[model samples]
Target: MAESPFAWIDEQARARRRAGLVRTLRPRPADTPLLDLASNDYLGLARHPEITEAAARAARVWGGGATGSRLVTGSTELHAELERELAEFCGFESALVFSSGYAANLAAVTALAPHGSLIVSDAGNHASLIDGCRLARGATQVVAHADPEAVRKALGTHSGPAVVVSDTVFSVDGDAAPLTGLAGVCRESGAGLVVDDAHGLGVLGEGGRGAPHAAGLAGAADVVATVTLSKSFGSQGGAVLGPARVIEHLVNAARTFIFDTGLAPAAAGAALAALRLLRREPERAARARAVATELHTRLTAEGLEAVRPDAAVVSVRAPSPEQAVRWAADCREAGLAVGCFRPPSVPDGISRLRLTARADLTGGQIDRAVRVISEARR
Candidate 1:
């Protein structure tokens, strides 16, 4: 009998099962009676009629896909419009859109940190940023989470071209990074700063201009930011915002941008519509933050351990992975959908129930969600 090359997969699966870390996907219906707190639609605009209509109209005009890689044939007028508006909104000198947020991060980090360069990354950065560092030709040193002093010390060790990479708001714990402190360290060391504001885009800053803008680092010569359109924009895509020269560099040198297909027209259109809507209704940003605060306050008041949310994410501590999974299931059964985070996803290896606060959620919805979470806790 021939040896099975796939036999190891079964062993790994068994180990995962024994450790209560098995993951399964559940398909959600388009219309459900459940109150959703698991999705990243912070502004609750994913299903907005205007946004959907924009998507439909774009597909009708652009014919579905982008047709090719950006440089080859994919750059359409809509994409150009999106890039311009996005840059203006975020206060960036220029911007380049990618197929996804992960791709954007990879392009920015790998392109910026070339050979002989030093990349100082925060310990709590998203996996995309970590992978970017791994793929880059530069030497990478991961510092303490949100510790500007650690970054400064690391930068001091290298005299070559350096860049500090971090997330504006950590997704796992929902705590915001000290952007001002990090920016200061980068400036003192003469290193560029790259921040992933995926979580902060539509939830932080004045009118959701973003964390970098709020930190007064927007349009700075040495600052670059990556954001996802999937979250608050209720669309599908990502972009890099920075100086025009850096944007040109990414276009020329970033493998992810050059090799990957362009963003879909529908996504670009929907994102643009969402951005315009957000501009008109800036109060949506504040409402999301308020909802998160309310959820945290109510959860903690119920004697549950929850991290104080800095954006629209609220993370509540769970006793174990199994308990966390069960708790999330219980909440779903109670007509409330929440997110469950476990071992590999959580940097600290602690399990948690992650809930998102949507701007459209009503007072009754918030009260009901908190009650369900409390009752679901083991």
Candidate 2:
């Protein structure tokens, strides 16, 4: 028999197994019995009755998917309305929706950082932002995580068009970037600042206006933000919010926007509904933050090594990748669903159990989660 052309696949699989880094999908049923601490639904609106009804209504009115790209046939009145509300709520002059948050990041980075431009990215940004920097035409220099001085130094090295990119709230450690300091450096250097607020929208600022709004940069002309509807908004899509001119430029120049199909109508509708719900029930945001603080405090008090959450994510360290996986599995067996982060996913190569705090989680549930996690530690 001829040697298989894809023999390298088996070798890589073996390597992953040896390194305790093999990953597999575990599709969840519609009605899960386990207490969820793995999802990004910070406001607990993903399955809300109002959100579901809006999704159904939009599907009935618009269909299951967007028919075409925004430039072709997919721009609907619903999309326009969502954009308007998103911009206003986030204190931006305008907003542009995309098929996913990843797409939005790619669009914002690639469109803004043209040839000869320099992109100073934070070391601990989300993968989407990292990929965006890679895809952009400009050169990217990664600075130390959460260091404003490093950003300033990087900006000093370049004289052409430059933009500073970072996550408002990092996903792995749940640490927040110094947005005010970054903005100050950008202003001093005459560079634009682009941030991904995926983890901040429903958990930070006054009534969850987001990290940028909290830092007094939301409406600034020199700043732009990308956010995911799948998170706080409890839907499936992403958007770029900024000054009217920057958004207009993205609509005209961003390849992701020009070629990719528009965001689904149902997602747009559902996100809009969730936004309205957040507006009416602003306490949900505070509750989500409180839950995170309680989880971190409880876990740490129990002698667990965990990062102090800046938003709704709590990251607990594990001794090794194998131990992290086993810990997560044990927690799952004990009726808790937690996120397990391992090598390649974590930039620092540290494995940890990631827990997401939701607004709807009760005090009893929080205590139960803490107990389960403490008992399940490897």
For every model shown, what is its TM-score relative to the native structure? Answer: 0.99, 0.99
Clashing pairs in 1: none
- Worst lDDT run of 10 residues, candidate 1, spans 369-378
Please give the CA lDDT of all the candidate structures.
0.96, 0.95
244-317 per-residue lDDT for model 1 (tens digits): 99999999999999999899999999999999999999999999999999999999999999999989999999
The list of candidate 2 runs beyond 4 A from truth reads: none
lDDT of 2 by residue, 110-221 (tens): 9999999999999998988999999999999999999999999999999999999999999999999999999999999899999999999978998999999999999899
Model 1, residue 267: distance off in Å is 0.3
Weakest 10 consecutive residues of candidate 2 by summed lDDT: 369-378
Candidate 2, clashing residue pairs? none
Report each candidate's C-alpha RMSD, comma-separated, in the order given: 0.7, 0.8
